[model samples]
Target: MARELMKGNEAVAEAAVRAGVAAYFGYPITPQTELLEYMSRRMPELGRAFVQAESELAAVNMVYGAACTGQRVMSSSSSPGVSLMMEGVSYIAGTELPMVLVDVMRGGPGLGNIAPAQGDYNQIVHGGGHGDYHSIVLAPANVQEAVDFMALAFDLAEKYRSVTVVLMDGMLGQMMEPCELPAMLPMKTEFPDWAVTGAKGRERRFLTSINLNPTQQEITNLRMLNRWAQVEANEIRYREYFMEDAKYAVVAYGSAGRISLSAVRTARAEGIKVGLLRPITLSPFPREAIYQASRKLDGMLVVEMSSGQMLDDVLAATRFTVPTEFCARIGGVVPYPDEVLDSIRNLVKGPLTTEGHPRDRWLKRMAERN
Candidate 1:
């Protein structure tokens, strides 16, 4: 297939279509509205289901309903909008339904802005909904990755019978890049045994998240926990650059990781032994890889578009044995490669220590700079 220049959001929509997504239900939200817009036109042309629901809540519930039928269903929303869908997300997870969700993160703890940010790391990666559930979260750093992960999201969701999220920032959502979308997949003719399809001549199947009995709920929770263990064992993914002989490294994900690559390259050019580690799966984070790298490195730098959210994970992964520094551009501000490069330079020059929290030190640095 020929690679064509495509906007990130539109490419993801087309990718999902090619992946045999049977239904799409979403509300218009910036940085991701193009995804819904594309689906609105394309889904109808392909005879698939598409609905621009009245709100995010309605949209997620529609996805939940479609997922119960064992169909490939999805919804896309930005930060504030996704927040509105939390209850439905929890419901879908508790019922052990498979569904895909794309979260094109924008600035926020609230309706902050339509600019790119990684503020939703904790929300999406840590299961924003109220429940003992886990979402298989994939963080893609570019348009190509965003497109590719759409199909993978569905596969993983079905494989684990759980929610899967394609987590990218607004930058990746709105940016354009050359990518080759996957070939169109034929929709499934056979439904899973657990599907809530009509009980025509067979046993009536029922699917619900509600478990009134405490013992039953505990069993369900244990089932989910065991499934999650399988995910952790089989699915941790990450990419490394210039790390074979490096003394220092930068750990990031999504857009921040993409930008950090440039810094890592520049640092190498200056004869500084620095590398990069970008996590592909944020939920089943590549803890072992980071821990292994920490054993050989003098220090690590974490870069993000949020206030040290992923940083917490990195610190725990390394057991705080190696000194770690942080650089962040929060509230819609995207940090430039030079900023990360500076952080790398500091990491090399530091009397690095693991005594205090990396965020606290980063906060002190931020105050000093301002």
Candidate 2:
């Protein structure tokens, strides 16, 4: 395929269309609004279904309906908008529907500003919905990753019979970059008898989580757990750099990670032996990769836009591997390269953790950490 320069949002829409997404339903939100616009223009041209929903909730429910028909459906929104879709996200998980959600995240809490914030890290990785459910979340760093990740999201969603999320930030959603996309695959829209479209030829498929009976709900929960365990065993992804010869490492993903990687190169030129452990799949969270890298490196730096939602994952993953310095900047602001460089500079000398200074873990509790 010919290489071309395109914005991240456009790349994702093209990727979805080419990779066999049957339908897309979404509401416009900042940062990711361009993505919907792109899909609106192109999906119809390709004969794919696209709906500009009345609201985020309606769009997500539309996803649920189409997913019930076994369509390769997707939806996109910013952080606050994603929060609005959490209920539907949980329902999708409980019903074990194969679908994709793209969260081109902006700032959080409640209508926080839109710039480029990784504040949605915890929400995306930890199942922002209410329940013991997990989505196969993919965090793409640049425009290319945005395109590449959408396909991965679809594959994983179908493979595990679960929801998958593509979590990007504003910079990733807005930036333009070169991409050599893979050849297009044949699209499929085969709805199985298990789907809840109608009783039709195969009895009736009950695609729902509303089990009012205690025994039924327990059974449903157990089924979801079994599926989750299987997913953990089979689905996990990450990207590693400079591990062959490195003393320190930084952990980040989405835009925060891409920039941290550039900073890693800068640190390398300055004789600082730094590396990066970027999480591509955030739910099955590449725990083994994290442990392996932490075992080899002297120290790790957890750099993120939020107060450090990803930092806790580092500590949990590296409990016996290595110590990590928690680095973060929250709200609508992002961490600059200098800040990441500074963290790497510190990691070059010593280990950093909660005990060293007492406040760098729970992001919401800022006063406690600083």
Candidate 3:
């Protein structure tokens, strides 16, 4: 199909259909309600299953059931709604089911605002429910990337038999951009050997998350950890810009990354050697990349919509070797390019104390913001 203007949420829905998603079960929530609305109309026309589930909890459970049948199933919601589905998501992960979940994140501590925020980073990437588990988290910087990642999400889920999450902010879901839509992928009707289809001319098989045997549970835990290690080794992805001979680097992901790119360019224009590192996957984070980049850079800046959740990972990546600073706009507000530019300027040119730390200088700049 020719490139056409599409809302980010609509593009995600279209891409899922093109990626051969067989079933969709979702409850409407702000900034992402259009995603479910799009699927509701399109899935039926494509002869696929679509359910406007009674609630977020029920929606995720429906996805879990469909995933067990070896079908490409999906569910989506915003922050608060996603919270309700965490228990179901944890169960799906425990069962080693392949499923795609989209989180068009909004600000939240409780029923917050229907505005963009990356506050869900810790909850989604680090496992919100009770278990030692990790979801393959994809953070797209634009609508096109979000569309492209939909196919990748399903591919990675099926390949590893793991849950994959596409993380987007509320703005990315509501904004419109020109997108080159992916072609339709052929649907699969045959079930996998591990799928829990009824026994027919074969021995009985069981699929359960309850491993009552302590030793067996340990073995399962080790297997999952090993699988995650492989994912970390092979699935980590990131994009870098203007790193050669840079004095400082800025790290951001998703919508924040897109905004920071503009700030990077602005900083460069003002004679600051600022570079950007955009992480595509949050789980298998680009640690090695950051480590290598930190060796040459004088300092690092972490920009986010949240109160520096991803910054912890950035600090760990650099081994706290370089002076790092953070800037954020919380409570559903997005940082302007000028605001990020100011942060970069402070990191690059602001006065450092006797200890040569940027904290005093960065704090002074932050205080000026008020």
TM-score of each: 0.99, 0.92, 0.96
Which model scores highest in TM-score? 1
lDDT of 1 by residue, 1-370 (tens): 9998999999999999999999999999998999999999999999999999999999999999999999999999999999999999999999999999999999988899999999999999998999889999999999999888988999899999989999988999999999999998999898899999899899999999999999999999999999999999999989999999999999999999999999999999999999999999999999999999999999999999999999999999999899999999999999999999999999999989989888998899999999
What's the distance in Å from true for residue 239, model 3? 0.4
Superposition TM-score, candidate 1 onto the true structure? 0.99
lDDT over C-alpha atoms for residue 110 of model 2: 90
Candidate 2 Cα deviation (angstroms), residue 59: 0.4
Candidate 3 residue-wise lDDT, 94-181, digit = tens = 8888989999999987999999999999999889878878899999999999999999999999988889999999999999999999
Ranking by TM-score: 1, 3, 2
Q: Give the clashing residue pairs of candidate 2, or none.
A: 359-369
- In model 3, the number of clashes is 0
Report residue 349 deviation for candidate 3 (angstroms). Answer: 1.1
Error of 2 at 329 (Å): 2.1
lDDT of 3 at 68: 88
lDDT of each: 0.95, 0.83, 0.90
- Tell how far residue 325 is off in model 1, in angstroms: 0.3
